[model samples]
Target: MKGFMLMFMGIGHLYEAFAGVHILQYMYGCSRDDETEQTERFGQLGYNGENFLEYDMKTLTWKSRKQQAHFMQDEWNSDISRLDFWKNYFSQTCIDCLKKQVDKGKSTLMKTVPPSVSLLQKTPFSPVTCHATGFYPRGVTVFWQKDGQDPHEDVENGETLPNDDGTFQKSTHLTVTPEEWKNNKYQCVVQVTGIKEVFIKVLTESEIQTNWEDPAPNIILIIGGVVALLLVVVGVVVGVVIWKKKSKKGFVPASTSDTDSDNSGKGVQKT
Candidate 1:
């Protein structure tokens, strides 16, 4: 079935090149009922973003969406060997492959994955967001509880969203003053389908994670760094000045004494 789909796509591309069509789209898939063991197959062809042809598996014929596509439809339907291949593939080959894939991934498809819950807040005054992510099966309930009971007011629930890893995430927001939550015992609860464990996060100042940072500490660090750098610069300058003074004091007197002795010897020669 997969091979046939690939071959059909290759043919479509070739047709697009010769027919001067900008785009050609081919969609084909199958669905099955687990209990009834019944399967249904469907296929469609699009030309330049418009429906051009459809396949009717029951009648074993192609249906033209537009009058201009009738010739192409007839041409495809007249190929007996292609029609036979489709009939056999849709009925047997596709079902067999689907069942094999399902069996190969049975553990992943049937197993339940638990979510990681977190309490997030942008600021102290903003609403507290209870985030639960990386759970499987998509059915999850997230809410806030106050003093061991569900809170009806000041709560907002968000829709479940899918992650790139095939897991799901959900969030619930609780809007309350800091004093209100601090005074009451507030908690976020996550209940995932097919799992017996209930995840809970108690609301507290320490537990609520925030992106906000205190500027006072950073400012103090900056000031300390500047003072340290200035001290280093001053120490370098002082060391250089002291070395120059020592060099001048040690060498200047000796050179002056030698010059005076040379002048006295010249005076003696003149006498």
Candidate 2:
């Protein structure tokens, strides 16, 4: 990023030397990864160029650089001449200068790393934030969209912030109602030049967290049933058995009946 700023400064200085008017152009801009990009330019004519002007790419408006106010210019011819000069300078001279710098081993092409994207809803009333970080080239776009269209209201946009690792970061938030949240029409879209495809995330139940109970009780019940059955089988196979005896009560003998019959025969003979 420092190298990039210096290069622009060098271009402005070289143009001033060539034009002999001390033309000063201060360009400032930033991007998140490569998705969304913006640039601001404030140019001057001489040392006391406090009345300088600038162009804002996002709003498509021109304003005074020092005062940060918009004004109409009646000097169309003068503006046109300066515009033409800059066009030629960037087209031919800028390219040649950059080539020379590369030949002299003063320019480099750094590899860009893709950003990490996250969609978060902190609270019920709070907005859903789409955050991206750790990207290169400082050019990226993060937006809240519905059905492929940009929402006009209930949206908050954040500035592109720098990270410690030299990558860029940005975030955007959308305040949605419960019906809109579950409608499946809301999505967060991200785009970066280094990445092949756009990154998109949606709000769903699968993204939320929930609590569940432990299964220890079910496991204990299963073990107890098995042990009880084993104890029953062992008792039937190895246990001792006891029997009770019955006593003799009454009996009839054959000698008693023969004696009674002999007594009856002796009584008849005496008669």
Cα lDDT tens digits for candidate 1, 1-271: 1111212342254344556646678877676777666667887888877889998987978899999899999999999998888788777887778777777877776679999999999988899999999998798999999999998998999999999999999999999999999999999999998798999999999998899988899999999999999999999999999999888877444455777888767846543
Task: Estimate the TM-score of every prediction.
Answer: 0.57, 0.44
RMSD of each: 10.5, 17.6
Over 139-258, each residue of candidate 2 has an lDDT whose tens digit, in order, gives 788887788788889989898899997788999988887678787577778887556678887666455222433457867877887788788777655453211112233354656677
Looking at candidate 2, what is the lDDT of residue 259? 77
Off by over 4 Å in 2: 1-45, 50-97, 100-110, 194-196, 208-271
| Model 1 misplaced stretches (Cα beyond 4 Å) | 1-21, 120-124, 137-170, 179-271
Error of 1 at 135 (Å): 2.1
